[model samples]
Target chain A: MALTSEKLAEPVAAPALAEDTPSVAIRNLDLAFGSVKVLQNLNLDIRQGEFLVLLGSSGCGKSTLLNCIAGLLDVTGGQIFINERNVTWAEPSERGIGMVFQSYALYPQMSVRGNLSFGLKNQRLPKAEIEERVNRAAGILQIENLLDRKPAALSGGQRQRVAIGRALVRDVDVFLFDEPLSNLDAKLRSELRVEIKRLHQKLSNTMVYVTHDQIEALTLADRIAIMRGGVIQQLDAPQTIYNKPANLYVAGFIGSPSMSFLDAETVESGGTTALQVGARTVPLDGYEGEGPLAPGRKVVFGVRPEHIVVTDAADPAAHVTATVDLDEPMGSDSLLWLDMDGHKLSVRIASDANYAPGSTVGLSFDLSKSSIFDTQSELRL
Target chain B: MTDATATYTGPHGPKPKRRLSPTNIMLYGTLFVVAVYYLLPLYVMIVTSLKGMPEIRLGNVFAPPVEVTFEPWVKAWAEACTGINCDGLSRGFWNSVQILVPSVILSIAVASVNGYALANWKFKGSEVFFTILIFGAFIPYQVMIYPIVILLREAGEGISAVTGTNFRLMGSIWGLVIVHTIFGMPILTLLFRNYFTSVPEELFKAARVDGAGFWGIYFRIMLPMSLPIFVVAIILQVTGIWNDFLFGVIYTKPDTYPMTVQLNNIVNSVQGVKEYNVNMAATLLTGLVPLVIYFVSGKLFVRGIAAGAVKG
Candidate 1:
């Protein structure tokens, strides 16, 4: 509850758009290696100055899709438009995009200043202009003091800063980041995550980031595209993806300690719809979904740990009676594992509250926040 | 508890090693024998080379010279004869320089480009080309000697017909240079290819995204980062071409013979008072170039080889 309040404290203002043209667009993008399809029929439109994140577990084609957008990988069939220009067949440099890699691929032999200026020099930019751009980038990255040092002479975070400075000096319209902070330790990862979020706010360039960490996707992305098996499972704003997951996978993936599922059958009596769980019937009032709940239909009731309340006394009108199986006390809160009939459920409570094993407790469910899905299709209904 | 604490005196740490334990004896004994086995011949050579002919004829090859003289080294440098040229290895030394310089430069330059292309900018059929090139490394050099001679002769004749001049590669120093360059290519290319392949792919991709073309990446990124490997290639080619005797004797005439071939001539000539000191001095002189190169860049050679070994 404290974490939710802290998250709600900060307002995420949507960037206002002056024009309708998307900065980068991909249509029917298809990529494969020999015969193994990595990404199939993928489509995306990144609005100007938008922060879009491609999120998934490993080998889910998120990085592959970022490479495709950067023109690093040759697509099997598709067209990519950058700022209204067809760049599917173009070189990565010609796509007017700057990219940062996870390995901090700054030139090892070159000084940080040389790394920033090498690209400009290759483009035949004037020496003064190159110097100016390199200095400006170094200043913005706060790496001006480390300019003369080689990459090996710097720490991991400093080297990553130089890598970002290398991209920042290009002044491209779009920025592509391929898990740029995945190499850092946890503390540095969180620090750099905030730095990257602040960077996006300052630059406001159309940025596409790739990461497998759900916390990163939730914190840094304006809109997150969750991918699985080379397909986009759902694409929406972070809060919407959290509160209103489109499918079972999205609901399970975006939460920590994950949402628990309970098998139930829909029942109707006297024009009142309810769910029968084991031997107890819970009212299905205020439930939001696509269609009406019919009697005798098999469905799954998914609920998050934070949405359930445990009462000391077993009220007859309570949702279900559960026995306290185990109690785990985390620093800020405690998680109670309870057994209802033959099913297991986890509920979050304040850390100070402790329950002994074998104690009977009544649980109340928040009907408005819970989800009901078709048992066979696993889709929200 | 006080009695227990007072009596407690267990061993605190690891047992100290003796200076001459059985394992140490066996290890150092084997090492000493190997060192003597390799170094004894060089020691004998050095002692014999510094002694006079009279001292050498006394039959004690290991004895230090009563009176040391630089005469043998001087004679080997300026007076010893190879065929009709009495100029000794001096002439052949210059000839070897011509062949060695161009051969080392050309072979390393071309092989490094071949490696960079194969490792990074892979074209269609590059693996097949690499396979064939590496395949050349396994073939015996003696088997290719005759065919290479024929190829050189035909190339010379074709050039003579076109240029309207007496142009021949059959018995010239340039002919030997080309042979050494071609022979050095396969192994040197493999060394460079493996080294370049071990460089992270992300750096190459980063260079490409930075607008670096093929040659730009080669000169700015690949070339600078690969200095250790280049030192490795240079050392391999220099020593291989400089100490070559078979190619020198077969490809070039006596006037253009390399130092090794001329040293052979001076030592194995049919009619001459055998000069043991001169021969030893000349043999040492022939090996000096590669010895100096190995000592100067030995550390980088190990690092380069280790780098190549990692990914392959």
Candidate 2:
């Protein structure tokens, strides 16, 4: 949370874009395979020198949208613009973008150097220039020692570096990566992820990355577009999306040890707004929203595990009393699952604070960091 | 307790297998029988070709020649008669060479490009085209022989009418080469298509994004990685065109008859003294080209065909 908060501060302190033209734009894009619509009327704008990540679970059309932007999949309708040009019908190569695939996709017959230079040779680039570019990309990726080795001789991480170098040698203005690190083990994935972020800082080219991993979306993206069922549910800076999700789905999808919910009804007594959960009345003094909460509205009170605190003293007016059901001790912290009159809720606490089963505890909700959602619309109130 | 301890030994894997186990006996015994069955004819052909005519008449066919002579090989190469020509199988050998080289090259080149296009650069009617081409593979050559003959005859007549010259494919070496090439296309195309299909689609997509068009991708990427399949195609075409007898007899006349047809004529001429040695020598010569090719590239052939068997 501290790391995320620090990153959240820097972008706000920075100035806005000097020019508003997006490096890549999609307008009413639609893609279909025969009768099955994979994407429909989707629109996105990627700013210059920005790293935009399309994040979702599997079959969420995030990869499909990235493919459309890369000019790999032909859109069934609408247009795509790159650098202000209408490149709806342009070939992938002509779109001024370089793409890395999940499988590394290096030519198995060619050495690493050959894999980087094959496309340039096809373009008929001057030999000296091709050599220089290949050398520079190899140096940047730190794969110069592997230049003579074929792809089969390299390990998974080294092969991926070669793949990125292949894209780097193209020297295009935009890069599209499709789960490029998913093939590696966890340690290498994190190492490569940092390198990719460093590469973005050095080159400052627009990048559109597609992945199903939420952590990758959180750490690397300037803006994250969360997609579900061919539609973008939310798009915002990672911190904004994490703290103030626009809908119930976004709130639930963003966090690990996901947010806990309590079924409640809003109450207004003497101009003071509050929520009634079972037998307890929780005050809504610090709850921030677009407008005042209406009385008698059925709503879901959502609070993340880390936002709930367990206290020893039970003050019925301020805290909900619950019995601990189980505690899972993760290395850094433990999640305490509690049963409050048959409603299950989880609270995050330090690993040293072990809670035995059936022990009573008072749970204090952080109202400022919690979300209240309308039951019918599923939107945050 | 003592018996159990005696049998236990230390914890280890199963006992080492006996060399002469029942399974090994059955496997090697069957393989040895099949090997002998296949090699017996070749052994007979070699022994029969080395025997003098007098030795063959006086002894059993299986016996080694009491008097070995190379006269039959020389006669098969220079003195044997086919139809009315005293010239031996050398002329037919040259004709077969001319037909085999062009046909193998043309068929493999065209079919590989066809496979590359069908597998990667798919167009509007590509699947339909592929279905039709694969359909052609199942039709028997015997059923299409007369129709092909008529087609070649008509082509020759049309060319003659246009050029006012005696241009004919009906009795020429080129005619047989075309026939061999056409016959070889279906199976060779299938082999190449299956191989290229197994190449990762991402590699093809990466190449397309890297500014490589069809030929560029083929030569720089697909072609180089496809050496095994190319070797497969070459072996298939070489063997098919080299051993062909029907097309050689039907498409070309005496001056351009292929080695197989010449071998047939020498064996069943119905006029000579039935020189079994000479007949065996001619048969061995006719079969030598494909045998030599198979032996030289035998390992690559297995590797190539096995590429399509298991896909990652």
Candidate 3:
């Protein structure tokens, strides 16, 4: 149970000690079933000890990619490297990765201890060593009391913990999780999510997690790989992916109460760049990008609901007036769906902030925090 | 009791009657009729088997024996003649045991492995063979009996050709076992296949990820979880092979005749005066194995059959 840093580092071979050698490197991966192409030339490099989450909705190849990395799936045309060793044709167990499934696939007929020790027994490990590993895993997961119980007798949370313990006892270099918390209730899911994050912190082992829940992706991933249509849209830190999405799809897909988009035209007035929406022109200040904003370029402007602000005594040059069409009073904040010159936009405010339907309010779009994409390409500009 | 106003009934209230309701009467009445209908034959068999030969001829079958005896049972088991074998059903019973034990084990072993392969490790043309086999089950044995006899004869001739001596299959209990196994294949395979298919795919995948191969997963996970269906298959095969008269008569020599055929020959032989008491005892004895199995496996038989029929 006392898994010190040195003990956890016992499995690393000396040849893999080179700095900058990625823990898992996937190159030009292609997968297909019959005629349907699921993944196409996908490439990724997972750093050592990094928690990388492959995040997307269903049918996006996130789980498929994780399975390929774990050697559970055969890639049609590609090479996979783990710790600088080519393992594209290796067996799943030989790949040195342990997986946790959404169903918590524990052996139903075995006690929790038996389930944890089954693979070790299959490999014919020494009895005392297997016992020590199992006890340590049970202690780490705090499932010592549940060790004697069958899977059917445990609660959902306890079963999932045992499933994690099964992987932990394997003493693998990487852990693959395929929506492990999806089957739990909301309360258990959040609690287990925190525990998983803590586990990652304590072990500092590389983890490749697959999830459709954006909260899990954002909170747990050191780098979140936002995928769409079998391609990695953006791979960056959580805040970077959130604030500066690579494309329109990533921007639209990441947030709850999704970012509102408005049709606009990029125009240059004097020497400053500004976007004109309907009759109002908002200055684009501190818009960090590569090139100058050309005049007369059609674009779509995006803003999160919480970033739009309403103020009566506003800077006349910055504030744009709109009418509140609907007000939704959430417990801590109110979402005001406003009519900005016939374009619908939503603004988030404190729950106690007074605002009524049909009331005229002065709304300001913070251009510094907003995103703009070219209309035709749908790429962030 | 009088202290509680809620429990006290007014004097003017209608008197409560304790007569059975019409629904209860109808339910119990139908159940009693069904029970009598089912038990009537067994009742007659036991009573008739206990009576003296003269007494059975004089009284109705529903009447109990005036002079009770177990002589008919003893004669039926050890002394009754079946085509000059006065050793009675004992030889046939042991022959059936020889056929039943091996047939049940071999049939189930082959069928379960076939089912697991069909359900999990699917190869090209496996399904075609399975489809043909299932359709083969619907064809009556009478249509294929002659071909099977010829096949066995040719197989024996092939061995004779190689070994330079007569190697007979037509007069052996092994031939009858092979027949029962072939006939019992379709339904048993279908039972095991559907049951294994209903197991969660994720569990199988997880086992594979845990370094389990085909036999490993089957022995460690699938086999343990499928005990009920195996019991169901055992029950089906045991009863089917034990009571099989057609295959027993067709495949084996008279020396290796199973209990059902021997019982038929002993009771229905036209040469002697009819002994109703002895006939009833032999019939009961022949039916005893399946009866004991059905009684002991009562609830599990029902559950297993239902489980095999449906998928989750």
Candidate 4:
């Protein structure tokens, strides 16, 4: 083994809270439906002007958490504070927040202008003031030409824009969005994703977005709260969450095609630490320290498909050989299904590097950014 | 580009003239037969009502009258007799109006609110009560009439005992209105409940977040959006209350009889020669209200009742 003197960096914990007052503060909140607890002891603090995303699969309490913050669902226990006021028992409207729904929820009978102005008119605001706010919102959302058209006349993208405009006209400090782009097609979802990012940049209002789409969560969120079974598995910045996940679940869920896990044992030889898989030993020089590494410790080593480099046969670090079983050409990158030591592994490499099937290739593992989970505890170590 | 070449192409490949397919012919033939079957009674009624009494007796029911006259319609509307009163169904017609306008309005108002509550503000035991109410719709009105009558009589008696005024609801239009409202509640509430339930729950949530209260949401959102269902409910109740003979007979005195009861009495009276033309005219007149309502609300009635068949 060639020893490289690389100091293992410490994995960063949760980022420090910003100095500004929190825009929305959720205390030890709990929500239960009869015998089923949907969320338990959940605490989240959203900073002013920050884009926070709550992400999970369906029935994972992400949308339920958004509803609780919006005051659409009554919390069974604990308090919700928006703008430093306890709004736990307040009505959804009085909570000083606006919301956009996945279904758009535009009144079918009303025109786009009517939909945007209905709430303001209900507050008995003056006609000119309502017009001014509505016009500004329509201009901001680029829906001025659609003012007179009913919801049925507009397409899905236009309807969502109107929904966003409805929230915009309210001129509130915080906005809650519940899977607003899930109804759109893939092209429209990406288009609206950018518009929403632009909206956050322009308006600079604190937003709480809920979605199950990991791409949207990664692209749009300043911090992502990955939830599972009503419990938040990890909460951190996108880069940190992507680079150093808190547990095996986060690691598996965050990547497309999922990360590959290999049963390995930590081995130490000549003051060098490494992981042994079958007959090959890979260096652990770049792994960030979670706890003390010891010899003969069992672990499940994980590596993302993109991080497994197909190395030249003559490279000194190339210790493993795999046969390419199949190739999925995805335009810019190709995913190769390989068999290494009787384990199927996916390797995403540049599409131009055409590795034909049935060909043998040498592989080098990038251990610096890999994950190692304790076998017993299933947590990052 | 030459005219002769264009003409040659057009003559060589002329478009085929449109023709109806066998499927279209079969479908239209079935529809025509069904239409005639439904219109037969209406044709007989209209033809019979236009004839003199002698002509109706002389000819078969299907034959159009050789000599038509307006005398039956005039007598039916103004002078036909029910018991000692010769003032005709005009009295009962006006009585129907009095009972109808109030009954329709009151029943729809109460049932809609009840449905709204059952749909959105579901409290404890609400579903139990709504289920019982909907099941009550299947029970025949006759089975429960006696109990309802006794209940109303006792209620009136209780009021009179306290107020010293004999509040007699047994023979009043107000009594008929109350009875109609009670009977109409089950079906109307079901119709409105299903319709309100079909409304996207998100809209209700959006309205709540828009600062709308209970009545505000109802008037501004639910009521406006549910106009079709309301039209359906109105069409239902108007025909039901207008054509009711049994309830009118049991609940009202002879003087306050509705058009249906009065029409029945005038036709079936034992003392006079059977004026078949006059009976047909009176029947046609009594049936006019609902026919008008159905005709006016033609497409909406079809659309409204099918409201919750597909989720929006």
Candidate 5:
């Protein structure tokens, strides 16, 4: 990774970006609270200088997993490795990992100067060295002028910066953020997200972040780990998770307006593979969805909301008839709700889509981009 | 003045509405009457104090005096009678200060330590300890006094042996101070516990992640955050101990009696001249510490109690 101040953050496609070495690796991790199991046999690998996002809903054990790695929580089973050294039983400070809590957790009584310098002071560093580190962190977070202000006097974004600066001053090997941007307003979240990315690039620190918003996971994660029910659904580059999702869960979870699903049995109508939805068999051309599928056994067909297109000039064999239930115009794209085979589905159409409530419309799926899933396991077919 | 006054600031450039009608006038007037009723004792005290022995003999208890003098304030300070002693309330005042100062200071500091630990440090049996300690507060002092006396007697003799003299805490100023502190601990600790609990857990977590250990969190974060509550605790503890009669009576030697005990002896002496002026003056003087506290902290009472109860 090269640093160029002239073109600081262009979000360039990384062709030469190495598969960086694992800075953190958790093996066969199990976390439990009394009789309830939260994380069961979880394995994770975070590479050096890589921004890894743990994407999940609340109580899905994303924050718990990060806490285990941060040494703020204990692992009941697995071993945690930071830079190839086992840190399963190590104290938090000894692990050299910095965590930004969801609340920002800035000390209210302490000035920004005091908050950032607290760690160094606790570590019993020399006064001059502490001052130097504080100054450097302040510069990095661009909070030099606000250093004298109390946390109450600072805005959410400024307080968040001070929190980041507190971590930066420690110069830790890994930085863990547990929903850092969740507290900020929409505008501030985006601004701080960019700042965090720049910070990571400049420091080249391996960072593992947790957030519920899929957009955040997509934008900031070099590699996103989509999780469900305390299990990692997929771990891949953002586009890979978007395009070639490993399972039905990942496919549905990654995209906004979500991917739609229908259980249908595979049949051959003419030379093309067709799905028998109730009594009508819909055509699926170039359907090479490769997973276990017994002919006549129910399997699922999936199409993203954006993939469903409505057209006036329709081919009867190629498209299905849909009655629009509701429509939402979202700037460039409009979402249309329609009923098909007793299931209500949403279609993301162009904002100029000449459709209205209760209107009969013809819908087509780009079957080449469609995915099939085994109904029982919900895995990609 | 009360009705027109408003704390609201708005776009109307402060044209505070005058909503005080006849009903409001009657309400305010009745409140003024009630306030004077509470002040009646103080007014009688001042009137009686200004009267001489001759006027007092008339026994017109509510009558204003023809002549006024500052003799009682002077006499109470340096010449009022104690049993077999008319040396005045002046002599016992220093003893009161000595007993009161250390008792208040020591109790407050100890209470803070207990409060911080009970509130923040969640360990095994910590809740049980807190529950039992709070339950201890509900126990009648009279029920526990006998056992406490026995413990003090045994402990005092043991100390006297070690010091090579007939020494004991049974009737010492130190004993009284310790007793006040232990009794005061439950309430003070309760105040501080509630106070510390309301402080955002975020502050504590931030300190810990920044390499703060237990002592670090307490001193650097919890202590600084608990200052307002600490002030209130000190005020409450001071007033409670200063006004304490039974504890001071039972625990202290005659030479070490606090203001309350001395005032009691001078006012309630058997066959003693009922010098209403001196009694009232002494009590008013004795009530002065809490009165001053109430005045100083009156406005901030709500804030001082509920300062950090909610997140900002």
Candidate 6:
């Protein structure tokens, strides 16, 4: 099977704690819509100047969490703190947070300059300073030429940049973005994604971004909070999330051509436990060595597709041998689909190799980076 | 910079260009027929207004006048009488303007307020108040005139102590203005409410986050979006209040009666032989303000409001 390389990283189990105050902290937050509980006991703390991204599938309460932080919603239970202030009961304006909506919520009647200066006007800023900030933000976004145009006159990308520019002019402590690049096309989405990261780097304020796109979350976030069913399954740096996912759900998420899983058992050899799949055994390596793993437990083998190597010549008694079913060669990286037993697995191949679709290739499973997980809880062992 | 202008094809492709066919022609023909059916009465009113009483009595209502004369126009404008005042339809013109102006202003103002409250703010009686207001709108104007007349009499007598008999609101121009404003309410609120609801919740959120208070959002965001719908609201209120007959007759004094009230009196004057030509002219002339408004701003009038405030 073809394998793609993944960057190694230290554990990012918790966010970086600053000596100063946290920008936003929500404690034991619970929210419900009608009768449905959307967020259950969500505890989150974001440090100042950290670009935190809520990475999850749709309906996973990422946007809900952003709204909660922005004071746009009332929690069913719990309090929210912004810049060390208890802002749970406060109105959105009092929160001192600026938000960029997915729909680019620029006022249609207002010009680009008006949009950037709108918040400042509301705060009763001086006319000169308002113009200065608007000009500066427009310059940063490269929308100075279009300042006189209404939102309807601007393109989708221009509108989003203006939305961001509006938030930038606020010059507040926190910047919250709810999938700001979603309205733009793929090319625009990537370009705006870079712009947001650069903006975050420049502004150095606490930023919380929400997106279902893993690529955006992975590239833009300082630390990614992977959510599922209103609960944060794992919150870690992107490298940690990609290399060592906290659980099966996280392993399944966070990576393109996702990590392949094989139902396995823990087999001991010389006081070391190796994960046993069908007719194959692989080392548990760093995880098994670090944590005390019980023998004979049903463990799931988790290995990234990027780590799987599809070779013509194979060494005897390799980790796992699976027949390659399909191969897709992307420009920078290729994807290889392998069928092991009944489960069809995806393997990320880093090169555009001239490989046929149904070639029966041997697999040398990379043991140093494999994950062993408990079958019942799906937690990494 | 290279990727800035790159475009991706959207989900659905562009639609095929349209071409008119025979079925389209048939549909348009049917629409034309329906339009003529609606406009036939207006045609008769004009045709009969220009004809002499002899020609009108000949019963060719659809036929054009043989000798088109504007003598009836002069008579309707200058010589019709209402209880010894022979100042014609012009007698009620000033009173009608007074009633129409104030009623339109007051009703438009109240509707904007009610629409703002009902759409965004949800106080205790908000929904119930809206329900009652809408119900009042749908209720026939005839059903409302009784309570209104009684209320006006009580109110006028209360104020008569100060202004004496002449300035009494019961049978004066002010009474009719109040009646027209009250009648204008239901539809105005409903129109603004529906229009406001269509606006994105995100726009409201942006405004709120921008530190705009309750009234601020309504005025700055909601009111500024008064486009197409403003035209709609004005036209609806203008037509309804302008063509108002029952309220004008019931509430107004004999001296302060509007053109519709005078038009009715002229047709039913029963002073020897009824002057049909002058009656027809007066009827058409009384309808002139709205008709001219429609002709001039007809596109906007058909748009349903007086102002195009909610431009997209």
lDDT of each: 0.88, 0.88, 0.86, 0.88, 0.80, 0.81
What CAPRI class is candidate 1? medium
In model 4, the runs with Cα more than 4 Å from the true position are: A1-20, B1-36, B160-166, B310-312
User: Which 10-residue window in model 1 chain A sums to the lowest lDDT?
Assistant: A9-18
- Model 6, B62-148: lDDT tens digits are 999999988888998999877789999887877788788888888888887787777776676887888898898678877877888
- lDDT, model 6: 0.81
Model 3 chain B poorest ten-residue lDDT run: B1-10
lDDT agreement of model 3 with the native: 0.86
lDDT of 4 at A243: 79
- Can you give the lDDT of residue A75 in candidate 2? 94
Note the residue pairs that clash in candidate 3: none
lDDT of 5 at A366: 72
Instruction: Give me the displacement of residue A286 in model 5, in angstroms.
Output: 4.7
Top candidate when judged by TM-score against the true structure: 1
Model 3, residue A90: distance off in Å is 2.0
Worst 10 residues of 2 chain A by lDDT: A9-18
> Cα lDDT for residue A329, model 1?
90
Q: Write the per-residue lDDT of candidate 5 for residues B15-115, one digit (tens) a residue.
A: 57667888889999999999999988778888898888789888887889888877877777778777766777876777777888998899888888887
The docking category that best describes candidate 5 is: medium
Candidate 1 backbone collisions, by pair: none
Q: On residues A33-139, what C-alpha lDDT tens digit does candidate 3 reach at each position? A: 76899887767788999999999999999999998998877899888999889999998878888889999999999999889998888778999999999999999
Pairs with backbone N, CA or C atoms under 3 Å apart (clashes), candidate 4:
none
List where candidate 3 sits over 4 angstroms from the true fold: A1-19, A313-319, B1-26, B125-129, B159-166
| Per-residue lDDT of B308 in model 3 | 81
Off by over 4 Å in 6: A1-18, A288-290, A312-314, A350-359, B1-41, B54-67, B122-133, B140-143, B153-172, B301-312
What's the chain B TM-score of candidate 4? 0.90
DockQ score for candidate 1: 0.73
Q: What share of the true interface contacts does each candidate keep?
A: 0.72, 0.84, 0.53, 0.79, 0.63, 0.65
